[model samples]
Target chain A: MARPVHSFVCEIGRVCSKAELKASEQPSALWVGVKAQKLPDLCLACLQAGGVFDSAFTYPSSISSHWAAVYVFCVPKLSKPVVLFSHAKQFHSVSAQIPAAVWDERKMREISGADFIGLNDLRPIIIHPESAKFVTNPLRGAHAPGRRPSARERSAGHEEPAGHGSEYGFAGTGEEGEFQIPVGPVHAGIIEPGHFRFHVGGEPIHKLEVRLSFLHRGIEDFACGRPMDGVLPLIEQVSADESVANGVAYAQAVESLASIEVPRKAESLRLILLELERIYSHLADLGGMAMDVGYYASSSRFATLRENMMRLNGRVGGSRFLRGLVVVGGMARDMPEDSLRQIRTSLRLFSDSLAKTEDLTLSSSTFIDRAFSTGRVSPEVARRLSLVGPVARASGVPCDARKHFAYGAYRSNAVRESLGQGGDVFSRFMVKLGEVKESVRLIEHQLAQDIDGPVLSERRDLSKLPSGRMALGWTEAPRGSCMFLVRSANKGALGRLAIRTASWRNWIGIQEAVRGNITADFPLINKSFNLSYAGADL
Target chain B: MHEFDALLSPKTDRIYADSPDPAIRELALFLKSRPLSPFSRSIAVRMVDCGSSNDVELEEGLTNAPQVDCERFGIHFVASPRHADVLIASGPVSVNMKLALEKTYRAMSRPKAVVAAGDGACTGGLLAGAHGVYKSGRVEEVIPVDVKVAGNPPAPYELVLGMLKAGQILSKKRI
Candidate 1:
C-alpha cells in the first residue's frame, strides 16, 4: 500500500514532479494506501517499508458519519510525508496490517462501533465488559453512530466488549522460555495510564505492545459546535505541555482556511513564544534523561533550570505554560515592554546556566554511561517509521518541519537542526539540548530586532467567519512540527479539525526501539523519546 | 568532605537548617513525633511517562520518579490495586483516564484513600470546565476524592500532604 517516487530540487524542497510509488499519495512508496479489505497488505507494506507502526485511533465521528477509524502512519521518506491517513467506516478494523493497531482498533470498534475484520487481538481496550452498550464517542459531536446504546449503557470512555479473547500470544521467532509481563492500565508512576505487555526472556524483551487510551477526553466531540475561537482553549486542554504547539496548529489551520494574515510584529512575537516553549520542553526532557541515568545532581540542576523557564513563561505569556496567550488570528495581548526585557534577561540566564549544566552532565561519567548507548534507533528505521524532531535528527534524517516548512518568522532566519548519528538516548538528548540553545538564539534574535505594532490581526468577527475553505497550519513546536488541518463549515465555524502531534507519530517508533532492549532500560529509552500521551490519545 | 560535612552537620541539620519552608519544618516535627519504620529498597518507583505536562515530575522528585521512602517509613506503594492500600490520582481526570481510575479504586480490597495529586487533579488549576476535561474540574467529580495535594503542581512535600492526610484518616479508622 506504500506509495513511492518523488524527485525534489535542491535548496528548497518543492515536489518537482511526483510518480505514484504504489497507490494514493503524492510520494507513493513513502505512504501506502489500501482498501479496507487490504488491511494485511497494509501491515506488510509498513513492515516492508521498515517504518515504525505508530498508532491507530478512531475519530468516532467522521464528517457527519457517526464513525471512522483514523489510522496514522509515521513512515520515513519514500515519497509521502511522515503522517499517513486512511478513512474507514464502522464495524471495520484495520489491525491486520499493523499488530500495534489492535488495541486502538478494539477500543474504537467497541466505543464507536468500528470494525477490525482480521484483528488477532480484540479484547476491550479500556471500558469494562459490562459497559459495552454505549455508542458514545464523547470527543465528536452530533455525528450519528450507526447504532445507539441501550438504557443500561453508560457514557464516557467505558464501553468494553462482552466476553472477548481469553488468551493472546506474542509473535516470537524462537525462545520457548520467553514470557510476557503485563505492566499497567494502572501503574505505580504519577503519569498517564497505559497497558504495557512485555514479552521477555531473562532480561531482554522480544516483543512489546502498548495499550493506550487512558487519557482520551472526548475533545473532538466537545468542540464540534463551539465557535472557531472557542476551540483554542479546548485544544490546549488536549495536551498541557503542547499548549503553544496545539494552539499554533489550531490557529494556523483557522488562518489558512480563512485566509487571515497578521502583522509582522505578531508573527515574530509568536515565534518568541514558540522558542520559549521549546527551551522549557527540551530542558524537562534533558533533566528526565539525566534522572533516568541516575544522575541526581544533573537532574536536579536541570530541573531548577526548567523551573526558571516556567517562571519566565508565567512572566511573558501570563500563565506558566503559555496558556491563554494564544488566540485564533494572533495572541491575546501584546507582551509588555517590561516582559520583553524580562525575557531578554532570562535568555542570558538560560544560556549561562545551560553551558554550566552541559559541562556538569557531559563531564559526568555516569550520566553519559546511562544515556550514550540506550535505545539505539538506526537511520534506516527512522526513515521507514518517519520519526520527527530530535528522534529523526538523531538517526541522521535531516527532516525538520521548522526548516522544511517555513512558518511564523522562521521563514526568514537561519534555523540549523541539531543532528546525531548513533540515534541513541544521548543523541536525542543532544538534539533537544542543542535545539534549546537554538531557541535561545531565536529569542535573542527576535528581541534584538524590535517588533512594534498590534499583536492581533484585523479580521472578520470570529463568530462571523467565511465559509467553504480548508487550510493547513504548522509550527515547529517543542516536540516537533505539529500540523493542524482546519476545514470550514457553512458558517464561519470549523466543520472539521484534524490535529496531529510529533508524539503520536513518534510513539510507535518507540515501541519498535524497545525491541531487544532490556525491560529495565525502558524508562530511560521512553524518556529519550518523551512522546506525549495526551497528544497521541487525542 | 568531613570538615565541610561537620561544619554543615551541627547547625545545618539542627531542625532550622533542613528546610526553607516552615510548613516543611512543621511536617518534619510531626514525622519525628511518630514511630518511624526502617527499611529501604534499591529501586524506587521509577517511571518514564508520555502524557500530561511535567506536572507529575514537578510533584515528585526530579532525580527519580519519586523516592517515596514508603517502605522505609510504614509507607508502601502497592503493586496491585489489592496491594495498594492508597489510591494516588493525578491530573484533572480526563474522560479516558476516569474508568481506569475508578477500576483501580474498585479493585483495592478495602480501606483506600484517594489522594488527588497535581493542580489539575486537585482543582483543575488551569484547564477547568473545558472540552477535554471529563466533567467538573476535580478528580472528585469522577470519583470520591479524600485528600487534595494542590499547587500549580504540588511539590513533593505537598504531595506528601495528601498521603499524610490519608495516613491520618487510615490511623483513625484503625483506632
Candidate 2:
C-alpha cells in the first residue's frame, strides 16, 4: 500500500525538472523538493490527482535566500501526509488554482516577506493596519521588537476608529437602505474578541465579513528559539479547550522527528485523555447552542454535565483543562488506575444525563424552529474551503483526521465518524451531540484494553539530536482537525512552528453559512459553529 | 412523554458544594454592614478580552454556571460598558487590541473599578515579552487595575472572589 503512494509521489517529482525525494524516517510520508518556479503547477497537479489541500506555510531558509515554502496535501488511502517543498523568495501564487491557499499565501507574503505574484486581498491579517508602522513583520529573523507607542500616538488613538467596515472594504449590495453594521474586537458576551461586519438591508443579510487576529500573540515567533520539550505549555495555550489535542500534535511532531516510539500504556492513557478532552469541549458547544435558542433548562443541564467532566479531568490528570499530561516522548506520568475506574463508572451516569438533555433539546419546537434551516453551509462550499472537524462532517464531508491519519491508539481502535446530511445549525448541533456519545464509547474501549507499560519514553531529551528535521502532527480536535508543522533547529530548538487549527479552517465556513441569514439569527448561527478566535488569530 | 416522565422522577444534578466561596460570603457580609457601599448587593461587570487564549473568558462564563453561580452573590455580567460598574479584563493586551481595550475603559463611567483577570491580564503569563503584545502584556500597563486575579486562567471561584474584592474597593472610592 505504501509502495504505490511513494511511486505516485515520485511520479509527481518526475513531472518537474531537478526534483529530489527527501529521505524521511516515517514510511507513511513522502517529501519531495521541486524547482521553485514549478510550485503553482505542481500544486495544481496534486489537487487534480485526488489530493486534498491540507495546509501551506513558509519558513526562513538555512541554505538559500530568505524564505522556503512547504505545501502539504493529504492523499486518500495514505495514513500520513505528502509534502512538496521548495526554497524560494518569490513564486506565482497557487491561490489562483487552489482557493484554500489564499490565506496561507497572504500570511507568507506578510510575515516571511515572500512575494506571491497574482495574490489578491493583500491586507494585513495578523498585524493591525494602524500599528503596521511599529511592527512590520515579527516573523522575520532580524525584525526588531515593536516599540511602545509614543504619547502623541497614544492621544491620537483615544478617538475610536470610525466605521471599522471601511478598513476591510465592507462588501455589500449598494442598493438603497443597504447599510453596514460593525460589531466587536470586544463583544457583548463573555467570548473571545474578533470583529464582525454585517451588510444588511432590513432583516436579511447581504454579506458578512469576519476580521480576526485581535488575539494574535505571535505564538509562532514565541516558539522560534525554544527547545522542543519546553513548548508544550505554549502549544496548550493555542486554545484552552483543545490543549491536549494541540499538545499531542506538537509532541507527535517532535517524537516523529526524533523517531521515538511511545510505550503501550502511555498510548492508552493518551487516548483516554484525548477522548475526555473532546467530550468536555463538545459539551460546551452543545450547551452554548441550547442557551442561544433560549432553552435554559437544557443548556444548564449540559453545563452541569460539562462541569462534571472537567472535575473528572481534574481528578484524573490534575488539571481541569487536562494540561501538563502529554509531553515530547509520551505521557507525563501514569494516570491512577482507580481514577480510570472512576471515569468508567461515572461515564454511565454522564451518558444517561446527556441522553435526557439531548432529548429535551431535540424535542423542543423552539430549538427546531430556530436551528432547522438556519445558517446552512452547502457541501460544495465545505469542500471548496477545505473545512475540517465537525463543521465539515455536518456538511456530509468525511474529513476526520482520526480516521484518515490515525496516530497512537487511534491506529488500533478505528473511530466511527458521525456525519450529518444537512449543513444547517441543527445539523451541526446533531453532529456535535453524536460525537460526544462516540467519545464515551472510545474512552470505554481504551479503559477496557488494560494495557500496562512505562508511561514516559527513556529518550526524553531531544537537545542532543541533530537539527533541520521537519514533521507534521495532526489531531482530530472537537472543533475539527488541528495540524502543527514543527521543524527542529540547531540543538533541538524549534526552527519553525506553524499551526492551523480547526477553528481557522471553519471560520471561513461561518462567512459562507450566514449569507442569507437574518440579522437576528446570526448569534444562534454563530454559536452553532463556535469557532475560536485565539485559534484562528494564532 | 420522556421529558414529562423525567420531570416527574425529578433527577436533580445540582452541585452541592460551597455555593459561594466562604471568602465571598464574608466579603458580602462586610460590604452589607457598611452603609456607604453602593455595590454591596449587586454589581454589573463587563468583561474585556484583550487577547487571552479564551481560557479566561471560558472561566468567566462558567461563573454563571450552576456549580459556581456567582449571580446569587451579586455578580452580573452586563452587555454594555455603560451599564457595568466593574470591568473584568483578561489576556496579555495584544498590540492590535490596545486601542480597543483603552476605548472600552474610556467608555465606562467614572467610579468604575477594573479587575485584571488571569495570568495573562495580570503579568502577560506565557506570552510576556512576546512581540504581538504591548509591554509585559498586563492590563495595568494599558489601564488602571483595581484588583488582579492570577492563575494560568483563574478558576470561576477565584474570578468571583476577585470581582467581590473590586466591589469592596468601588465602595471605598464612592465614599
lDDT against the true structure, each candidate: 0.63, 0.81
- TM-score of candidate 1 versus the correct structure, residues matched by position: 0.75
| Per-candidate iRMSD | 7.2, 4.1
DockQ of each: 0.19, 0.47
What is candidate 2's lDDT per residue for A1-538, written digit by digit as tens? 3576766766565556542445243543667677687887778777777778888888777765447788888876666777887887576888877787778776776665456778866666777776554343453434322222236644754222223223655567677889889999789899989999999988999888888889888887788888889989999888999999999988888888888888989888888888999998888988999999899988888877777788688778888899899998898889878998889888877888788888888889999999999999899989888888888899999988888888889999999999999999999999999999999999999998889889999977787877788888888888988888888889979888989888988887888899888998999999988989999887
Among the numbered candidates, top TM-score falls to: 2
DockQ of model 2 vs. true complex: 0.47
Per-residue lDDT for B98 in model 1? 60
Question: Using Cα atoms with residue i matched to residue i, what is each candidate's TM-score against the true structure?
Answer: 0.75, 0.92
Q: After superposition, how far is residue A60 of candidate 1 from its true place, in Å?
A: 9.0
- Candidate 1 chain B — worst ten consecutive residues by lDDT sum? B3-12
